[model samples]
Target: MDLNWVPAADRPDLVAEPVRPALRDDVRVAEIDPALADTAEFCERYGMPLDTSANCVIVAAKRGGEVRYAACMVLATSRADVNGVVRRHLEARKASFAPMDQATSLTGMEYGGITPLGLPAGWPILVDAAVIERSEVVVGSGLRRSKLLLPGKALAELPGAEVLPLAQ
Candidate 1:
């Protein structure tokens, strides 16, 4: 799909208040096949030397026979260390990655194309602090074959995202 045809406001609602700058001026957006959204392939295809890209992962924790959804935003440079940081913060005995089947089914986003922008409500987004410093970074566009490049700070403010010192 050509994002150029979609007006900024008409774009899918992000989790955060819609505060996008003119995307073309501050960052770049690329539309590639869904296959390229995979971490290894995205980096290789884009010739990105670093993995500072934001990885949107869905996590599930059982809350009294019900499951809660959360979004984990880790720097591709590091891991979420869910057991160490995320679980502790959530006060849960265990926090696990949602199965690919469940995540895709719930988020309506392809497995590799999940971006923090359009996650389900009540899903807390945890962001690694280091990502805040990057002038520009690539992240999923709620669809396969498309990626958004923009100032890191703009991403940090996405709805429900809590910028925390969660990275190594």
Candidate 2:
């Protein structure tokens, strides 16, 4: 994709505040048009395939008057099994996408740019098996104006991350 990849740690401004401390040496960041931050537009504009992009979706799960939030990482071409696999995995009676305001505020990241890297402590990060098998993948940098590129294995190594067949 011809991106000028730079160490994410060296470009703190390119990532969200919470993401800064989680940045690993293997992660790279590249600037992009904020308008193209969405998966479809970003991949098409960069001539990248859908399989090379990953999306991190925030899910809100509830059980016995308690709500737990999780981040699900799925390939751009796949859909997260939120109602099925996720609900069961989280042991929550109900699971749904987190509201934009809550997601952004809790993650300390922009709505469309939330990434699993810097999620709050104790939040389960369910990573689709397909995503972790890839050698490299593009993901949000916690900011709409840039993107993060790293080996798929890196995602699986994040704190609270769990590799699972969570995509359908």
Best by TM-score: 2
Distance from true position, residue 110, model 1, in Å? 0.7
Per-model TM values vs. the true structure: 0.79, 0.97
- Point out where model 2 deviates above 4 Å: none
Off by over 4 Å in 1: 1-28
Q: Kindly list the per-residue Cα lDDT of model 1 for residues 73-133, writing each as its tens digit.
A: 7778788867778777766778899999998888777667777766777678887777777
lDDT of 2: 0.94
Q: Report the Cα lDDT for residue 123, model 1.
A: 74
Error of 2 at 126 (Å): 0.3
Q: RMSD, model 1, all Cα superposed?
A: 4.7
The local lDDT score (0 to 100) that residue 121 gets in candidate 1 is 70
* Per-residue error (Å), model 2, residue 98: 0.4
lDDT of each: 0.68, 0.94
Count of steric clashes across candidates, in order = 3, 0
